[model samples]
Target chain A: MEDIIVRYISRIIVPFVQLYGLYVILHGHLSPGGGFSGGAIFAASMILYALSFNLSAGTKKLSHDVSSVLESGGALIFAGMGLLAVLLGTNFLGNRAAGFPLGIPGNLFSGGAIMVITFGVGIKVASTMITLFYSLIEGEGHSHD
Target chain B: MSAAAHLPALTVVVPLFFAYLMPLLARWRKSWCAATTLAVLAFTFFSSLYLANRVMSSGPFVYHMGGWAPPWGIEFYVDYLAVFTALTISGIGLPVIVYGIKDLPHELKEGVLGWYYTLYLLLMASMLGMALTNDLFNLFVFVEICAIASCAIISIKESRECVEAAFKYLVLSAVGSGCLLLAIALIYMVTGHLNFTFLAATLPGVMAVYPKNILAALALLMVGLGVKAALFPLHVWLPDAHSSAPSPSSAVLSGLVIKIYAVAMIKLLYKVFPATFAGMAPVMAMLLWMSTLAIIIGSMFAIVQEDIKKMLAYSSIAQIGYVFLGVGLASHNALLGGILHIFNHAMMKAMLFLAAGAFIYATGVRKLSQLKGIGVTMPVPAGAFAIGAMAMVGIPVTNGFWSKWYLALGALDAGKPLFAAVVLVSSLLNGIYYLPIIVNAFFSKPEGAVAKPGRLPAVMTGTLVVLGAGCIIFGIFPSLVLGLVSRATRLLLGL
Candidate 1:
């Protein structure tokens, strides 16, 4: 973990990795990659940072409490969007009938709630991966002590 | 736009919606998380009741998810059987959550209780979804959700044994999921459909053309669900998982979660497979033998267990056998008995587990031998456990009696008197294991100084009392449940 070349390389690479993850998540409606893969890509960047630096550095970037909140927030966003349709007197998760403006199909904002849901999912998956990594690694240290 | 039309979707979504909010609410106020969970489950319980009423009065009701019609999109199908199963799930869930409020703090470490509640709600939602969904793929997805949530709850205690048990349960259940996914894939390959009704309509023709493929799918589905349901030989993972889990988790996993898979299996056999296929395959005969073994062997194992929870876990394996026996008999009375047993067992087992949890919470004694004369000290839970045991033994005027009666009658109706004998002998075996626990708890001398019973929370005691009273209420007024079971049986038999 103390190797200079590896740390320097990861420091340079992590930002681009994270940018690509955001791009995949935002463009999910128009392309194949979506929330799950994008979220994994973003999580991988944090994991790389943890590997190059120490666990404490990783925690400084995304603390446990914040990651937990983000995890729940993502799920809430998805469920809230679904409930909006029910509140609007359509079926649960009914998209078109919920009165959200559906833009042109090929555009970034075209799919209305789909894009919102994918964004929520992206946040959730990324946070979940980080949280899981922290717990497993932190648990290992505790057991050793 | 009728409110009734949305009940099916709401029954599942309401609990799921709350589950998502649980962690956030816990971050704000831990008590709010528990309150939200209980409130949503209570709502789901009533929604299931209203849906059951609608199904009874107006026949089956179907809700297309997102307004997409079936054969393409997911559908929520609420038949007599589905509503009955959903009602049992949400009904049991409400009380378990109420019981959990007092019991969980003892079982879980600080700071992780929210996640436990989250998993609990998710488990309930997925079980309800599994019971109600008409799409084969949707059912598989729900099964996976239930599997993961159930495993997480088991490991929540964070003891070495709990973690090990959860790992074993995960691996075995993952295998079961694989089998189920493969079976669904095969069925879809043959018919190009995943909706149950559409598959049922198309399956007869596909079976006629490719009998072997249909049979393979049936076998895989049975084995897959059988593992999840802990059907006798496939139940090795169940005892450790159920006994080592935190009390309410054990209660839900043993009491309600295992039963839903059986319900799914029954739905598939009766609704999807044609009578000709059932007759040709010897599937019923195979189930008949497997269940008979499950009954005798599961009880025999229970008889030797020292740990009370392990004994109860083994008893679940036996009780599940009775349900499958009813299904395997495939007669009007037997199928009715099997379906009814699902409801009855849920009540009795959840009561027993919660009562056991109360006992553990009070005295921290889990061994039956250590429980000597403790019943005299802790009378309420002991009394409830007595009722559960009596119900397990099929005593007259207890709920278990009626299910066994119908199952025996079913065996007779099916011209299988040997199976009736098996049922009788199994009841006697049930008496052997259960009677001792009751007797030892009340009558035997305390081995050491009798530990004074600690005060139990009202919510915990109240849920036990209600479930205990339910055992007798349902037993005395069998008509309350018989009407639904008969209708469900008739639907299954196409009568």
Candidate 2:
């Protein structure tokens, strides 16, 4: 990963890939590509950065501890949304029935808790991917084979 | 809907929420992981009991997710059978976690303890989800979660054998999951419904038009669940995985985990598939014969295992066959026996595994031959093992007898005397393998590590005691659980 050209190109492209991931996650409720795909896209950027740089560099960028906390935090966000419905005396994951503002139908922040849940899933999946890559690389060692 | 209506969702969601928090808790407060797991499993247990009570008092009901009525959204159907399976899961699960609190740290690294709890809770939630979910796709999701968690627990030990065993299990389990997904797709294609009630309603009409598709789905469903359940022939993955896992993991894997698949299969076979369709395909007859082979062969293999845990793993295959035998017999008594065996075998196997764990913990002895006169030194674990062994042999006073009795009676009821003989021969095989260990432990002289066994934690000893007592108590008073078992049987048989 000492190749200057590869590292420089990845550094330039990573931001754009992440921005696209965010865009997909934000528009998830209104569009086809939701949390899972968007999250994978974002994770791909991080993986690319790691591959282009090095494992130690990747750990510095997203540290195992941070990625792990984000992993748990992301899922908590999703579950918390569902629990909010239960607390509100509706069924679990109840969207409109829980009386949260859905905002304008076609706009950002629309679709009530779904957008938030999607955002949470985005975080969960991205962090999970990064953590998996870091552990697999670190645990298995960086061998060409 | 009232707060009580939310019980089904809460039962699954609570554990999942706690599971996500476990690794963080491990980092911040390592001690909290075990206590939190115990508390979460306890909550699951009591809620399942409450659900069971409500079902018994009134009848079955459905809880829709997000207030979206199904055939459109996921639903939790809280019926006699659902509650029965849920109660079995949480009831057995709680005790296993209690045993694991003391057992896990001894086997696993200090840092990964939190991760173990996370996997444990996820496994708990998924099994409970599998029990209650009314939709086929939802069942598949839960099945996958259960499959993944079970494999992780095995591999978490990080030993060579553990890793290899887990890999074998993962491959077979993934194949099973694929078969299950394809079966669901087939069912969905013909019925245009994923909800169990809707599928059951529509399947009969579709059965006439799509005979081949329906039959293929049935075969795929059986093979998929059977592999997970370790129903002979397809059970090559079970012995290695179960034997190599840590004691508490072994207890749960052999005890509650595999049985859940059998429960799922029972639900699909009895509820989703029409009786006429089952009759047309000879599914029950096939189950009967396959179970017969599992019983005979699993025991024969068990009789030869030198490792105590491996023996117990093979024994689990045989014990599960009893449950399937009951299901296959299609007699009211036999089905009752099969369902009851699920509970009975879970307790016995868990107790046996924990006792085996205690032995290994104290003396570093796993081979049955090295365990001479272990009873003389470690009375508590040895006594529990004795109780479990007696249960496995289906002694008159143990809980195992009632299920075996019902299975045999059911065989007679179904006019299959040969299966009754199979039951008798299996019991003899059970006694042949299990009795010697007890006799040798009690009568032979203590030697080497057995002479001065290390101390067992009070909590570990306490769990074994409780499970052993449960075996005898439930054995003596079959009425305690029979009410639910009989009712579930009647409903499934459409009596």
Candidate 3:
């Protein structure tokens, strides 16, 4: 949209939206929201930015190529963490018994590999959302911008 | 535990790990996509072999996920049946993907090629997971994965027909998934356990109290899995989805994907449900009647189809009936015949589809009439098609005969000579449809496009050769697979 008010508001509000998403992802083990929800929330900020501006501006911010790489990388990281447990002589995706230090139960870093997995999932979900949106829009006969 | 203790998990995980990497590799190292896929599938194949060897030597074993025990944690049970299924999937999947290596670029867009590999690997991992998983929820998860991946592969061709067929498959498959989830919920309500072993142990106790719920669950399970397995009347989505798909996809879907659900159904029916349950008779009878219909109708439909893949797709519905008929018969030799048919049919169908793909790739023709004298120009694919046709007809010395032999024997053993007659009639039907294709290809003179086709890829032809050989070799030595299938039969029958 060409309107000043909408762009101004989105510019100011987007960063905080991203911050909340990160909070949810980091605290996934301690609280309710985890990778999927947090990542969707994170992606919403970018989607808002894209909506307020033009497709070109959105593409400039996160190109399709970069988003795809991020998508694959996120899943790879998740699988990699599980493989790490297997390498540690524990089962695939083994948690506390795999010898990672479990901080206080309610602490931010206490869930061993859970937080990391959530982080990977969050990144994956976010990029996947962006890619999905972009592809759908691209598939249309004309770009709105 | 040693690293050797991890083969079961590794068989699935390795493919999943590579699937994630496929798109990335496709972008930066475009050439690596197919090679990486091959390598990943090769790993799955060999590991499946290793697990089969281990299961044969030591009997069945279970592996706990994340070091947690079952009833709480997910577990993979490597029984003779599971290993047999795993072996069949990986064995056939490896060659199909090998064929896809050359065939895919011709069918799909340049950008989606990497994603195709991703979908193929995901499908592979999910089928392996379906085979080994002992948890109800885990099985559901794998089933969904397999469903989505299979659909994606079909629609990746991006043709109008492909997209339409995929949508139909997606809708029907989703309904099937919902039914399965509800059935699992019902089972959990009564038994209070998601693990197969725990469910089996507690189900009998609850059966006397909640007979209706148990029966409802059984009915839903049968319909749910039945739809996915494309059992008879529920197979509306299969022909379009399988035929419109890329050839490699057709090979996998008709060859292995549908069979996995049948394996899942067999597991639930034989392992979890108490054999002496009061409702067993009606269920088996229902299965017997449904399969009889599927066999006859599927073959009759095949006879009328002008499109080659469509005909093959219809035939699959019939072939799957043989597996179910064996299960429905509920005798030792019957179940043996059913289980053996799985391996035999997988080889035959995969080879046939690949051979069909080879023809389309070269001649760009799909009509049955136009394939005349195809044997003269494209000897390898045409010859492969001939062998596949013979196998389909249950001609002696082809693998198809042995399964039919057992099914017929099993029917007689079960005191149901009628189904044996049905088996014979279906074989005749099979010959009626399939034999004409061979005779026309080999005996008739070539015309326009069929006269001189494009060059066939070595890899594609080579895959056909291997699959065709597999049909004959396994036929000549039924004992090779019979040992496992019989053991699986004994285990299922609790003999």
Candidate 1 lDDT score at position B1: 72
Tens-digit lDDT track for model 3 on A1-145? 7999999999999999999999998888899999999999999998899889977898899998899899999999898888888888888888887887889999898888988999999999999999999888788736455
> Each candidate: how many clashes?
0, 0, 0
lDDT of 1 at B284: 89
- Candidate 3 residue pairs in backbone clash: none
Error of 3 at B298 (Å): 0.3
Q: What is the lDDT of every predicted structure here?
A: 0.91, 0.94, 0.93
TM-score of chain B of each: 0.99, 0.99, 0.99
TM-score of chain B of 1: 0.99
Off by over 4 Å in 1: B2-4, B447-451
For model 3, the stretches where C-alpha displacement exceeds 4 angstroms are A141-145, B278-281
CA error at residue A42 for candidate 1, angstroms: 1.7
Pick the lDDT winner: 2
Cα-based RMSD of the predictions, in order?
1.4, 1.2, 1.5
TM-score of candidate 2 versus the correct structure, residues matched by position: 0.99
**For candidate 3, what is the lDDT?**
0.93
| Candidate 3: tens digits of C-alpha lDDT, residues B1-495 | 777788888888889888999989988899988988998888888898999899899999999988889978999999999999999999999999999989999988988999999999999999999999999999999999999999999999999999999999999999999999999999999889999999989989999899999999999999999999999999999999999999999999999999999999999999999888824539899999999999999999999999999999999999999999999999999999999899889999999998999999999999999999999999999999999999989998899999999999999999999999999999999999999999999898999899999998899999999998898898899899889989999999999
lDDT of 1 at B108: 90
Best by TM-score: 2
